[model samples]
Target: MVHEYQKDDESSVNSADEALFEMLGILPSLAIGNGVPDEEDDENSMNDKGGAQALSLDRFVQRKDDNWIRKVLANSDNINLRRQYETTSVCVFPEALRIPAIEMRRLADELVWGGHIYPSDKTYETLRISKDGSIEERRALTRIENFVNYHSGWNALCNDYLRRLVSLALGQPMVLYKEKLNLKPPGGSGFAPHLDTPSLRVALGDRGPREFCTVMVAIDNMTTRNGCLRIAKGVWSEDHHVNTVQPKAEGNPDADGRAGAVLPELVDQLQFEDLVCVGGTIVAFNGWAPHRSKTNLSSFARRAVFLTYTLAAEGDFHDAYYQEMEHLRNKWRDKVGLPTQISNDELMELNALSTVPRT
Candidate 1:
């Protein structure tokens, strides 16, 4: 039941692979105890028939196979994937880079100082259903928003290449906004599964085609063990009515239970995957995709920043339900960066950023 994205010091598997040889309880020919000499000795002998060489601890440590164990007991009925379906859309950015923890330390400091810290349980913000929900505290500090609106240099780095790549992937023009930070305790989950609020919907109704996206930039190396953001792939740009679910709990329990409407029969159809990232690697997912994070299991703290963007002509989507998003936009209008126009050369460079491996 514990789903992890790719973990550090662990192996990663490819999506196209149909099976893991070990799942059938058959040891692979490559197992450590084969007849081949140990890899530690240079120029080791190889079996002419199978061309198999001995595996040294070095080779063993360097293998790149994905370690996620596929659910064998269930297929279309897997509960984990089904649970993933309710939150957001999913997409795997192949060959993602894991940010080194050393590089992420500074950003981690910023997150803690920024007052973006939350319990990951959504208890801080109250919902209409809970009598005490409205009384919940807004733990955020304005300085954090200021840093995003001003000090964050992400807009400059978004570059024409990143924008065009996003446009091509999501089939819409995209822009990079400021990065968001998350600092929660172990067993804490970051944002619950939900769609990104459009910053420009009322002005240009959610009709045909999406006009923007929010790309997540990992300030810290994200791994499955530490609860990376989980995404439901390929569901972007779909139009779904926003239905408000009233809380049935007396205290409006929390946002997690209220945000998703369970599909009991289709639970078997849901699929979830952890999207792990290295520092400097950005995860460009459809802002509308239903996504959530697993509880952190690692001993270290989890910190990440998000860069939200919008299409050139689209109205803001964040203010649809409330006046806050509108106020935030106007208040920080001067700080928002305009999406850059990309050229042909930039497009080629962006393609180079694709980290997927070749066969």
Candidate 2:
């Protein structure tokens, strides 16, 4: 679980990512996956396109065929989601995304391995020495960020479906802050208990809305053996947890360090519950929630997409956040003498390779 927001205008967005923004009323006049018709088309063609766009908007409002989103929204209200969020800082909706787990997994695979969504430079992998002294690699935790920029389907999921749910929980109109595709392969590493606020503060210092919420849509069945998320009980906001920003040596030892990691002593005091969910489950939590996961001990991969949002009134930081992170990552890579870019072939190979030994 992690939390990370803002509204964007047409002028502020690029062509690729503008569709959803426009539909959200953050901009105007563009339907996702269906752009404006060309001038070369006949009058009838333009009229048909216009009708389709209108129908899309109608469907979005009525949620005609997308009952899963509607059901999740209804359930959110049924559970007194706002109160639960205020008290626990987290909530879960099982199979909320509506799509079958297999279909979700397929979409994830295509986004990662299809080689069209994410650019070569945006793909990365982590390497470690095995017990047998062999070099093994796993896809990096933040495999793809701001994926909504590339694929229309993902764009809708984040800006349309998940965004509406977050807005409901937060009791305000929310906008996209950032989104990521997290892939944890069999034997892949897990994150340490940490609050996302510190890292977000570092990336978006005084930018806009500081408050944030995250929605994680499970793409595969998440279980203890497969590195399911474990969130601590309590609202660990800056005011509630004064020492949240203090780095502890026991935190993430990887490139991210311990910036947001909680003190081990404090973590020991909190009651943690493992969130085991079937694929398509939606887990939403505030940025202040402290959460972590363990390495996958099972023989399958654990995959999920995390989308973060902030109050729309705070101004959009989506583009800025991604740009800053990219810059920092590239700088760090350069300092370490590693290639800053990855090739499509290499990305595919990395996906094919496994840290897990075959039985």
Candidate 3:
């Protein structure tokens, strides 16, 4: 359950804090094998497309659960902060820790196998997968796209820190549900920008409203030269919905259904800015926030991962990519026991290691 942000008095706040601390103390030492103390230096061990280095989903789920708990409690102190703020987006520079290069490579290998591009990490790094062309038939790229979602980091990459940050800003309980995601590299270009479906009034019909938030972590130095993410600040407030890049002057065929509606005007007026951050920094924003990524021009690969979460009980939590691998999808379905599940506060019963500090 999310920690209630609005309480009557100081005593309650202190009590809540103490309770959360006790919970954190009793939480079991999540078996995060990658973080073991005696592990060897593995900054660059990821090489093969498929090997024994793949991350485990159990660890990812545990970490995500811990993250949800922290997020609910952390935002109680900032319940009123948004009223004074102009935009909903919040960026944290120099995030806590970097998911080492080896981990990234291990995850990247899975990503590539799942049909993502594995381009050289050099200046002008970019990811290219033809949406509708002969290039889509290429064996190597197809494999990458087919297997990326099954990889642990594909979902785990949306680390707990990023999730907590979004929960704090939105002032709501956030739950990550999407199991499948598109893996884009630096210099990648997505079709014109547009708001998410649930963000629109028309789309909100009875299908349970979409109240999702997205958290993006730059796995590399994101710079304008190398194509960083850009956003249209404040546009979400006006209508909370924006169109895609294609020009829609009242007569355009809206024909190409694959490419969402064109919002040439909105796209033009967008306040474009790159999400310039180091490898570990996190960026969070509403699903409806109008944003686009610049073309990658950096020599080093501008690798990054995105995680989108909605209220735990409000929306669908199925992995869309499970369609690609039905067996694996069923396995995950079996593991996820609850239908409308949130993080289990039971973890609070265990104690954290006193000798080891949270790095």
Candidate 4:
């Protein structure tokens, strides 16, 4: 089963959606053309995976009359209620932006050259789960921060349709709150099942509002073999159970260490949505959704740009976000008794001079 997050109107569904369906990791012609899955399959996916087909959601929350989705799906621009994402936790826009092959290559090269790449940090919560089920982050992989600051092309791409989609999904106005470049090399470690809201609130420092939306724009083809994102269905922050599967175990390091983890034992309790998106596809999910991905062992590298937005009323936190990241990094380093504070000029020189590996 191939699950696609898209505008509900059948007439408005574009031709690009056809291309998206072809790129899926699952069987394209399952002859299963209905909106959501049958009740039995929706309950538990272990049986499907046992039958040689992994747990896939053709539609978890695609019900037409769903209150949160109905208004936004009406195609009206006047409505501003952002609760749909809160209800479903995830949405997808297929081929939302068309990038030529050459342009996509250029984007990758430019980001590798100018982007400040860092190797995996095992202590970091996002990089904690290694592919082998250990808590180790792999080597020979790197990532970049402040990617939006150096690239105008990305900003243009985001502004083109991301804001409108976000607003429609959220039912309110939106603003770019954060941006990050995630590069998963052959041995890159993926995240565990966890909600994004906990870490986000820490970064936002208890801002007046709580919820935010994320638009993950795929720069490379994401497949199950290449560690694509897998999300649990029908779970949100407001409905989250306090005594439930721990995404991160207790006594890790920080306040958020144990906040978002979904134990391997409890993973079967929730229905899983495997995302096998083609390049240029945009995935919009809410903060409280439980999502995780597998490590990349495939020959090709997986690169993605995550564009996160806060409600327009919450004020733009882009600068504050990076500043807070820097502050927390410094504090963590100091607590562990390590050297701190690497300036932008130093980082640029390192990348420009080819000191450590650029990629």
Q: Per-residue alpha-carbon lDDT of model 3 for 24-135, expressed as tens digits? A: 7731111111111111222222211235543343443455454554554355455333442235443442222234434443465444443334321111111333322322
TM-score of each model, paired residue for residue: 0.45, 0.68, 0.50, 0.61
The most accurate candidate by TM-score is 2
Show the colliding residue pairs in model 2. 5-310
Count of clashing residue pairs in every prediction: 37, 1, 31, 10
Full ranking by lDDT: 2, 4, 3, 1
CA lDDT of every candidate: 0.37, 0.58, 0.39, 0.51
lDDT of 4 by residue, 1-359 (tens): 11122223322111243355457643222212112121222112323334443322222212212354444455445422244455567766423122332234345556665434422111111223232343443223245556565566655555534565666555678888766666665445566666666555554457534766778866556777557888775647655732333323322123324444554566567776888765555678877677777765443456677777878887777778767656765665576555575443322222101111111
lDDT of 2: 0.58
RMSD of each: 17.8, 14.8, 19.3, 14.0
State which candidate, 3 or 4, has the greater lDDT. 4
Q: Write the per-residue lDDT of candidate 2 for residues 1-359, one digit (tens) a residue.
A: 11101122312212333454445654221121122222232222233344543233223434523455556666644676777778888977533333344445555766766566454224344434242344444344335556677776667767776677667655788999977777765455677677777666555578656888888877666777667888986765668852554533322212334466676567677777999766666788888888888765433456787778888998888888777756655565566565666345453333211211111
Please report how far candidate 1 places residue 208 from its true position, in Å: 15
lDDT of each residue in 2-117, candidate 1, tens digit only = 22222366432211111343465532212211122212111222221234643332232234222211221123243333233234444323232222223234444533443353
Error of 3 at 36 (Å): 23
Better of 1 and 3 by TM-score: 3
| Candidate 1 lDDT score at position 109 | 57
Candidate 1, which ten residues in sequence have the lowest lDDT sum? 350-359
